[model samples]
Target chain A: MLSSTVTSLTVLLIVVFLFKEGVGVFDKTAMEEGFVIAINKNNPVDKLSSEQIKNIYDQKIISWEEVGGKKDSIFLFRVDDISNFYTDEQIGENFEMLPYRLSSLVDSFPGVIAFFPEKYLDKNFKGKKLEADKVTLAEFFGGEEWFPTAHPSAQLGVKPLILGTLWVSLGAILLALPLALAAAIYMSEIAKERVRRIMKPLIELLAGIPSVVYGFFGLVVIVPLIQSTFGVAVGETGLAGSIILGIMALPTIITISEDAMRNTPRAMKEASLALGASKWQTIYRVVIPHSISGISAGAILGIGRAIGETMAVLMVTGNAAVIPHGILEPMRTIPATIAAELGEAPNGGLHYKALFALGCVLFIITLFLNLTVEFISNRKKAHKH
Target chain B: MYQIDENKVTRKKKRNQKFVFFLFGAMGYFVVALLVLILTFIIYKGASAISWDFITKMPEEGMTKGGIFPAIIGTLCLVAGSMLFAFPIGVLAAIYMNEYVKDGFIKKFIKQMTNNLAGIPSIVFGLFGMSLFVNKLGFGDSILAGSLTLGLLALPVVIRTTEEALKAVDNTFRQASIGLGASKWQTTRRVVLPIAFPNIITGLILSVGRVSGETAPILFTVAAYFLPKLPTSIFDQAMALPYHLYVISTSGTNIEESRPIAYGTALVLVIIVLFTNLLANGLRKYFSKKVKMN
Candidate 1:
């Protein structure tokens, strides 16, 4: 009982922490929240939008001419650049001097922009402090682009990622469901016991293969095969991710549905056979309808595995954050995005929070699917009872 | 005429049955063929790169060459650390669910929660681990944080497997033990656990296989992109095998040169997982025979 309590508590804590970090991206004015961006006063650019700021930081808007300033290159600076900004002795002697030093440093570089904590901003400073527009919830949910670190503004639109994830998972299910259902039916009804004994272990072994190995295989084998087959410039497409995920999901689907089918009452099958029905007819008419709930549960579990899969999808999916038009196009999924980006996102930054929010989305989707499976299986049990 | 029509209908039914049977058989064969193909392809591609020195020495020259000793150590450490936490809690939970609690609301709820826990995506666990352990808990990117995350990841599997193992033990043995004036706890500890021990070990081996292959949960919680030295403590960062394969194959500077190494690393990982799985199957068979003898 205590162990179960701990497990539930850990899950609760994880949800809470993820939301706490994820929702921080909506802060309208970062300056009010202790962080601000300061730029040189002499620059002709009086104000900048969040989009413009992101572009500058990303070095996409390299020339001042791009941002309506004098013809000079933008120089980006951060307070953590200790070597270029301050010595250890100066920072140790007087903490207040740090802000003064920052104002002076901004003043010294005519084409420079610096970001630091709000407490470090000087009222009469030579540099000007730019107001950061708040990130709206609509922009986050409905935005078409996902260039989170774009100059002048961070684009947190997750539409492409959402669409991409759905595409790959849907494609995977489409590919896997038929094959898995056939295998399940065969294993439970058609195959001899000896064949099942040998085949069951092989299928279970498929589940045990590490996802990274699958990714490697996809990178070297599947990707090239698709490339040549389709004659696309690159083989790293959503098709490759779907194919690998379909293969990965097969074990789960086969195991569950086979169990469900095998559990059909022996008397029911006997009665169907005694009524002049063929063996295949008895399986189709009596067995399948009897275990439809279990079959759906298996499918849901397979879909859950496909949607949540990370490493293999990350390797073959091309990591392109675009709304994929077809299965052959490159795309990215939510889990792959989080796995690829979380390492570089600075802790507590908007980019980091955005990744957490992505995690939150993924969590909710899988949780919903899992609950559906549980509900279906529970209902099936209730019916039996 | 009626007899001839019935004969034609039977023939059509026979043809349909044959075709359906053939289709199902083909599907089954396809699945098996896929597994064989993957294994052979990996072995054939990776065989040339497997050398004793490549398995023993540290990586050098921007990881374009040298062995993967550090990654091997790191993977071993992670597996051990996760088992250290997951094994005990899982066993105790199973004991509570199977032995102590009656088949009632609480047991049902716990079982449901365990199912939900198992269904969560591993990358979500990665995010949770990153926030809770690495950032909020101040463990930073270290082995301890990674193991805790992975332990959480493996806990559901452990709990479910252990519960099954315990439930598989014949209830008459428990009744006999209790009828002999033994306390309930004593009967459980002395009678039930002994019978369940081999299956529990099987569960542990399976969880070990699971923990060793997982990549996403540890990606943020512990795995380093490149760390030359072996970790001396849980707090230190270390490179892990799965992550190493990911980096070299996907994002390495010299992808062409490192392809062989990626294949070799993948081969090693597959062998480890397959070995553990085989060991578990063997143990289950051995113990079941022992039970038959008893």
Candidate 2:
């Protein structure tokens, strides 16, 4: 009983830990520690929205007049750009004179917006600091950018990641459904007993292959194939992810749907045949209609796998954080994001917490899918009884 | 007119049959063919990299020129370690659910939880393992941490399969043992368990295959990119095969040069996973045949 209870409690444990670490992100500021966005002290611009700030950094806004400031070209500054102004000696060894130089520099350029560590700004320093907002749940969810390590403020928006996951998963199901359904039909009705025996184990073997191996295979074969076929510069597009995921999902879909198809009564098929229906007509019209529930359950379970699939999609999907405009464009999934980013994120930091939050999103999605599968399977059981 | 109509019907039937052949037979065979293609491709490309020396020596020179002995050992250790943690707990859990619990809400809940656990993605397991084991418990990316995480991942598979196996044993056998003056435990130990043992073994083997191939769960909890010597303790971080492959293929320093080694490692992993699957399937078939004969 203890073992059973513990096994059962793992689900709850996962949710608790994920949320415990995840929910901390919203309370922290969006900017990296000890850094702020500062503009020229004489400039009249009082505040910038996160969106406007992202736009400016992205270079969508060129002039101060674009955001209610005076008509002048805006100058962006990050500390790395220090070399553009000062010589190596003037910057000092280890940048010891950096604070004075930075302060004086900000004082001189009236239109410059500087992003630097707070230590660089002395008490008498020029330039007014912009109050970087705390990471809000709204911006985290609906925000478009995903620059977790951005200097002025890390854009922790999940919109692109979420949409990318959806697109890849959607594409996988579409590609897998027809082929899996057909494979199910063949295994159930078309294959002779001997052929079915061989095919079944091979399919199971396919399922047994590791996901990383699939990713490697995708990298070597599918990615290159997509690149050459579509004439894209690089081939790690969402389409490549979809193809690999589609193949990975096949065994699950085929197994479930085949079981359901096999359970269709022999009597019904004979009856349909007696009515002068061809073999195809009988199986298609009778067997398919009977097992539709199981087929959908399979598709949904496949979708669950596609959504949560990490290493393969991560390796093949180019890991671009942008929201994909098309399947040919590279995209990133939530699981891939967590997998790629969590390794470098310091323990309990905002970046770490954000990754855990991504985990929470993944957990909820799979839970819903699991529940749906259960609902369908339970209803199917009910029908049988 | 009647003769012409008969001819048209024959053509239509032929077309229908051809469609079925293409739709079902062709598509099914295509999936199988795809699997064959992958296996052959990996084998063909990775063949040159495999040798006794490659299998047993230490890696050198940024992982470009040496053997994968440490990684192979690491993967095996992880597999063995995780099974040690997962197997007993999983079997006991399955037994508790199958032989002890009466059918009702608790049983349903347990079943639901098992399915939910199975559906939880591998990366999520990595996150949880890193949180609870690596940081909170201070196991700190050790084999112990990786094993426990993998053990958790394997637990659901073991329980579900063992439950099914236990369910397969005839209830009459248990009742007969009890009628013969055996205690409940005695009945289960002697009568129900013996009949169910082979199927349970099959399940364990299958889960082993599963645990060995997983990359996501081990990525954070235990994987080291370039460990030179073998780990002498469970707490020592070690290089794992799947993560090794991931690193070299995508993120390693000398990716282009290490391609052959990557393929070689992938070949070994595939062999291990596929061998276990076949072993489990063979055992299952053999046992079923023996049972029928008896």
Candidate 3:
């Protein structure tokens, strides 16, 4: 009971933490509460929208003419630029000289835009404090791209990642399901007792192999193989990821489906064989139909494994956050995105919250898969009783 | 006409049978072939890289050369740390469920939750670990946080396996002890537990394999990208074998030069997992034999 409580409590705590952090992205104060953007007092751009500012910082708007200013290039600055702009001594021992130094720096550049804490905004400063807009929830979810660290504004649209995860998982399921079904059927029905005994342990051993090792194998073998065979310049494609994930999911699918198939009543098989049906017909007509629930359970478990897998897919799936047009193209997955980005994302920042949101999505997906497996297996049990 | 139809039917049956046989046989062969190919390829690429110094010394020259001693020790620490937390709680939970609890809602809920826990992806655990332990609880990136995450990962496995072991302990033993005037606690402590000991150890071995090989859960929580020295404390960040393999293979500065080291790391990891699995199998066989003798 204590252990079980610990298990459930862990799950509860994880969900709570993820949602709490994830939903923080929707809080306007979380991003804009303490920060203010300042521009040169002589700058023609009186007011700018958050989108325009994001673009300006991203270097997407190179010339001031793009944002209705003079046709001069824009210069970006941040408070942390200590080398070229201000030395620690010049900024005072406790940074008391920061406001003066920053205001002066802003006055010097006609096309300068800077971001700093609102407390540093001097009343007589020579810079215009632009009215910063709140990052809307719509911009995060409905946005097309996911450049979270883009200058001016972080692009937090998860559309491409969501689609890429689906595509890669679909490709994996498509590749693994048929092969796993074949192997499961063969092991349960066709293989001799001795072969079955030997094969079962070996298949379980496949699950024991570290996912990182699989990723290593994918990097060394499958990536190069795909590159050479397909004549692609780069081998890290969704196809390579799918193939490795399919191999990884095979053990799960085979074990569960085989167990389901073995549970078919002996009388049914004997009856089918006694009615002059061939062994193949008995397996397909009787054993498969009887074990359909188990097979579905296996497939669901396999899907769960493939979708949640990180390192293997991350290593193979070219980490490009683009909507892939085909299986052979480079793509990124949600889990991969989190694993790669979370290290760099500053704690309590928008990017960090966004990554946690991605985790929430991943958690929901696997939870759904788990529930489906349980439902299918339970229904099977109910029927048996 | 009847004879001709019968002959045609038999021929068609024979053809179908042959096709079915080949299809299934080929699939079974494919599974075995893939395993053999992976093992042989890894061995072929990595065996020469393993040397006495390589096993005993710390990584040198930006991890492009020398041994993986720190990583090996780090993995050992993670395994021991996780087992320290997961072992007793899991065993006790299994005992409560198998020996004490009857058919009830609580038991069902526990079982359901455990199944759900097992199905969660290891990477999600990594995220949880980073947030809950590393940030929220302020353990930072330490062995304690990483092992706690891995302990959560292995909890369901331990619970289920120990439950199975306990279930396999015959009811007659409990009843016989009770008939000898032993109380429930005494009977369980003296009789049921000893009988279940070997199987419980098997479960522990399996969880050890799981903890040692996991990369994702440790990646964010405890694993350091280039800490070359052994961790003096659980609070200190450490390099781990699986994460080392990940680093060298995917993002190393001299990926081309470090390929051999990557293969060596993978080889050592596989051997460790395989050894633990063999140990579990050996214990199961030995215990089953002893049980049969009694």
Candidate 4:
């Protein structure tokens, strides 16, 4: 037991190391490049409407003429040769196309309109003559445009990313908690032992499955269901992400709370029943209060799960950086944002640092939750004594 | 025993019988419904895609399609590499925790730390791997980096399980071994570890299953792009199955194109996990039988 505890502690220490390094890289990255907005030379605009921006991004308006540029067709450029817009040689010999290359390409192409990491926008790129100066990087991120690129300046003056993260996780927890609690109550207090054993493991197994599988499941089933049911053209929205997250969280919450409730002293349950209480009443008034700490802990753990979920939310949340207008609106979350961009962020830049900052926030939340569970469990033991 | 009372007793018996049956059916159905929903869905979607060629081949260009041969090999390397590093250290740590050091402050601190570690999010582990194992150590996009990271992730779980298994062994066995004039180490080696072997195996199997499917930590540490050939060395880059599935599923493409591949991957993953679970269960039972015979 002693040696095992040491080993586990060592692993935890490693986690501390990981977070420090990830954050360290991010900090260095941010300090090196503060902010800049690289705009398209051909489509240089003082400004663009949200719809126009959407259409351009979606490739619906493929010609520069539609956006008041040259009549030539807009060639959407990506950093890598994965797409045909730009050749590998054009990106430079040493430039490995990290994920952020797409944004950089959009900014550089004449008929293209895109964003890039602020640090990468050297004096040469930023100083390149534009037709207009009305649209600044600050206004793009700050004025409610949420294109989270690697460079800080490419944020487009928007805080939508942060809002989207919080809102989706909150919505998922709200939807999942009640259902999980009720199922746990039924499974633990009311079900027979044979039933409990089989049901419990099955639920636990659900938690063990990878979240990416959940993403696929959401893409094929939940997205289409939402689109048809809500009469929307697209179903990939905040609601879809939240619903998928909620389903994933259910098993964790149920199992933890059920185990806690089952461990509650049987003497308490019997006493309640002897005092002329019905089965439901005995469960509600006696068993539940006794295990309230565990239930709360389970809920917190579930919240942590919802917050940390990556692929599922990223796949279904429409990758929009805007704060959601409603549950049905497309949104983004902190974890999703990190997963979506971390691959492309230049090593040791500010854009990378901001991602680490988001990670730090997530870490704090999870740490607080785990500590609270330990604290409450200890308190319950103290009360028993 | 009167005739007038016999009807009431029969009615009560009938009601009790009906209630018990209802309880059993409700609980059974609740479990059955979920199993049917998830398992059937996986099989229905995945069965068509599974072929000998598909299993033996590697992924290629285009959004979807290809076999998972490289992924399977990578998953094995990760699991094997992690165990190679984790097992001895974990076992030694368990021994130290269980046999050495009387109750004290350091012991208590270690206990608290381990508990905290178990609950840390996996993504944090991934970040740590990126910094310490991948960047600082200069392992750089190698299977070794991923293995080390996963080994770290599995450490806490193995330690906790091994300790529990050790504690479960009866104290009397240790005392008897000592009574025979055997040394403490001798007694622990011959009497205690053997008794705990089954539990340790169970723990190890569970850990392997977890490392095999892990994605987030590997996302930063392991190779993401397709590798047509198998990794010949631990230092070589390899593509992991879970990470591959994640990339395919979230490539920002339509699901229709990606569904067949995702289903095949999910089916294979589920089978691996379930098989591991069964293996653990079998070992546990065999050990229990051995204990009974003794």
Candidate 5:
């Protein structure tokens, strides 16, 4: 009982700690560390969203009018650009008078927005500091950029990672379904008992093979084969990830559905056979329909595994944090990102918490999949009863 | 009229059946072929690297030339450390669930938690391990931290297997023991556990395979790319096969040069997995026969 309590409490503590570390990411401001965006005191802009600042910096927002300011072209000023405003001598040694010159230049331009470190600004500096927007849920989930260590701002958008996860898993399931289902169908309904006995343990062995080995195999064999066959510039593509995962998933999908198909009531198969149906027809018409829920549960479980698989994906999927356009393009997944970056991220830093937040995303997805599996299996049980 | 159809299965039906079976059979063969190709390819590439010295010597020259002795030792350390921590907790938890608790909310809750724990991704486990064991508890990326994290990851599997093993021990044996004036604990310790011991041992052996191959949880917790000396205490880090393979293949200083070493490491890890699986299966069959005879 003490052991059970320990086990339960461990799971509880993990969940709590994961969320507790991750929840702060949403509150973290999207701006760079110790950096402030300051405007002319006379400028009417009260606040600017992170997106608007990013756009302005990118020159997409060239006019101040775009952000509810004066109808003039915006002058983007950084602390280093003080030379354009004043000479080096005027700026002085150690830049003691640089803040004065910086504030003066900022005050002179109607559309000027100065970016500088917080320590440089005195309370009475004429320029008014504006609040950059905190990382919003929308941007965190839906925004495409994921440069968590970028300067001027750490882009925390996880859309590409999420989409990458989606694409690889979707492609994997698509690639795996036909082979897995057919294998399951054959083994459960058509194969001889002798064949079944040999194949079953072999398949289980396939499932038990370490994923890192598969990843290495993928890197060595599949990556090169895919490269030469497709004439791609690179070998480690989303296609490689999908192909490896499809193989990894085959055993899981086959085993579950085979069990389901075999569990088709003996009477149902006999009835189908008696009705002049062929064995193939009996399989599709009776066994498959009878165990549809269980089959779907297996598929959902496969997707969950594919999504969470890290090292293999990390090795074969190119680990590019970009939304892939096609299966051949390399992309990163949530797990790969977390594994590849967690080491360099300082403890309790913004990047650290963001990775935890990514873990949160991964957890939520897998949790949903697991619950769906639970629901489907429970429904299967209910129908049986 | 139906006699015409009954006299010969429809040509269309026959063709359909043949085509479908051919397709399924092909899929199965393809999977088998893929497995064979991977295994033989690794062996073919790595067999040259499998010298006795390679097994016994410390790695040298940026892990390109050395045998993986430290990694093997590290893997052994992690496997032993995790098994030590997880087995008792797992077996005891299984006992509490299968024997102590009846079918009710508490049992259901524990079962659900086990499933959830099993379903959590390995990388998330890595993250959690890094956060809790390495950082929060100040274990600081040592063998202790890595082993604890891996033990947690291995816990659900151990519990599931042990529970299944315990379940295989029939209720009649428990009743007979109880009828003979044995207490509940006595019935368990004296009668049920003995019967379940082999299967539990098999399960424990299998979990060893699972824990040893894990790369993610040890990535940050305990794995070191190249340590000057072997770890003498739980507080030190050392290389592991899976993580070592990962390093040489992906992040090594000389990946192209280390290809042979990478293959060797992968082969070694695969062999460990294969050995455990075979041994577990052998033990399972042997135990089942012994049980049947009794």
Candidate 6:
């Protein structure tokens, strides 16, 4: 008894810590994005409207000619080779892949002005000196583009990532539900016990395989399959992501639904058979209805899996930062975006907090779905009683 | 007796047999398809990469240029750590619920909650750990945090298994122990636990297998990356196999180059999972044989 109490108390303490950190991220995002300021001293175009700022951030206004600078050609200056921009490695080792170094490439090109993280910037750059002003930083924060390694303490937008996440997850869940249900029914009610005994473990084994393997499989197999079938130039889109996720969700649905169907008492099936129903008829009318609650629970859990999947969806989904208008359009999911950007996000910065907020949203979604399933199942049991 | 409809009955029975046979064949084919497609592909891709050097080297800056030593170590640490935390607590809870507690609202609730927990998608557990263990407990991205999260993840499974194992112990054994003037604790410790130990070990191995493969919970909690150095202490960071594979395949430096690394990692993980399942099956089979003999 004492041990059990201690166990529960330990669990409680752990939960409290997670929520506290999660909440800290939320608070930080609010303060950073809600109000801040910036000042660019080298160029007088800092006082621009939100729309103009959006265009500039989105790389639409690439040259000083477009935004009014020294000449038609923009002499862009970005951070030199530096480690703080991205790679968690020594400067010599990581300079090759570092975003600041990449930003230099962008700078050297004609009519290109790029930025990187503040820590990467030094006195070497000669173009824009973005002074630390709360108002200007706030203005940059309001834009809808996100390039995390942007120089200065400003100019990071998380809107595209946020939109990308919603687009892919919604698409995947829509695709997975019906197929999963059909497969579950076939496995639970139709398959023989011997077949099920073998099939169940194989499917569960599929679940145990790492997400990275699924990601590669999606990249190599599903992408090509979609391209050939649809005759699209690019196979990576919301639809491809949906299909991969559907495959992943299959075992969860089948296993849970099977358990539920197995729980339906023998008497119920016997009664249905005695009423002169065909085998299929008894399966559809008697067995399915009895296990509907379990089916729903399984479906929700499958959706949760689809929502939270990272690497597979990231690899195949094309990762375009746009709200998907159709199944064929490239999209991203919340988890994918979080994984892609979280490492680069400044620890206490607005972008980092926003990413955490996205996690918070995902948490709420899974939590609500789980609790609802439990509630419905409990009520269902009460009704039966 | 009268006019026997023997032909009609024979024809109907034949049709039923034909349908059942077709259904069974189709189900068998489907099962075989899954096993063949996945296993064949993995083995085909991964087998060639399994070599001595691949097992020993550390990962370089690029995933394509490295080995899976840290990941293998991290996976072992996670499994051992999770077992350390989960086994005792889960067993005790099961003992309390099954052996001591009488049927009531609390027992019923615990049963319901355990079932529900088993059904919860692993990502939620990730979220729970991200919030609860890593940040709240301030065990920031260390092996200990990962283990605690995974321990929570495996607790329900352990509890369920222990409870079932306890219940499966024959009542006569317990009654006989009492008949021999043993106390409740004494009987439980000596007879019930000894008989149930095999099943408990099976459950433990299976749970360890699961923790080793699980990426989502560890992603949120542990998160060691490209660390060439082994963890010298409990609080030190260490890379895990699943995350290594995830990095290699997703944000890979070069897909062509990383293929061998990915293959080797997958081979190692699959071998571990298969071994645990085989171990559990072997133990159960042995015990059942013993039971039959006695």
Off by over 4 Å in 6: A2-15, A29-188, B1-32, B57-67, B101-141, B167-182, B220-223
Return the clash pairs for model 5, or none: none
**Candidate 2 segments exceeding 4 Å error:** A38-47, A57-59, A62-114, A120-129, B1-11
lDDT of each residue in B1-294, candidate 2, tens digit only = 335686688689879888877877889999999899999999998889988988898887888878898888889899999999889989999988999899999999998888899999999999999999999999998999999999999999999899999999988998899999999889878988889999999999999999999999999999999886799999999988899899999998999999999999999999998889889989999999999999
Model 6: per-residue Cα lDDT at residue B90: 89
Question: What's the TM for model 4?
Answer: 0.77
Model 1 bad stretches (over 4 Å): A28-133, B1-4
Ranking by TM-score: 5, 2, 3, 1, 4, 6
TM-score of every model versus the real structure: 0.87, 0.92, 0.89, 0.77, 0.97, 0.74
Docking tier of model 6: it is acceptable
Candidates in descending lDDT order: 2, 5, 1, 3, 4, 6
lDDT (10s digit) by residue, model 4, range A304-367? 7887778788889887776678888888877787777778876655455556655666677677
TM-score of chain A of each: 0.77, 0.85, 0.80, 0.67, 0.96, 0.67
Tens-digit per-residue lDDT, A1-385, candidate 5: 9998888888798888899888888878978878989998888999886767777877789888898887988998888888776888998988888778877777888889888998888657888889777788898888888888876778888999999999999999999888889889878888888998888878887888788989999998899999999999999999999999998898889899999989888998999999889888998899999988878888888999999999999999998998779989989999999999998998888899999999988988998899889988987788777
Model 2, residue A70: distance off in Å is: 7.5
TM-score for predicted model 6 compared with the true structure:
0.74
Question: Residue A81 CA error for candidate 5 (Å)?
Answer: 2.0
Which regions in candidate 4 have their CA more than 4 angstroms from the true location?
A: A1-162, B1-32, B60-65, B252-255
Candidate 2: tens digits of C-alpha lDDT, residues A1-385: 8998988888889889999999888878777788868888889998876677877888889899999999989899988899999998998998888888888888899889888888777677777888777678889899998978775567889999999999999999999989998998998998899999999989988899999999999999999999999999999999999999999999999999999899899999899989888888877799999998999999999999999999999999998999789999999999999999999888888899999999998999999998998888889899889
For candidate 6, give the lDDT of residue A161: 55
DockQ for model 3 equals 0.70
User: Candidate 3: what's its TM-score on chain B?
Assistant: 0.96
| Superposed Cα deviation of residue A64, candidate 4 (Å) | 31
Query: Per-model C-alpha lDDT, please?
Result: 0.88, 0.90, 0.87, 0.72, 0.89, 0.68
Deviation in angstroms for B217 in model 2?
Answer: 0.9
Number of the candidate with higher lDDT, 4 or 6: 4
lDDT of 5 by residue, B1-294 (tens): 335664456788988999988998888777777777878888899898888998899988988897899999999999999999999999999999999998999998888888989999998888889889988899998999999999999999999999999998889999999999999999999999999999999999999999999998899899998887889999999889899899899998988989988888888988998899899999999988987897
lDDT of 6 by residue, A327-349 (tens): 78788677776666665665556
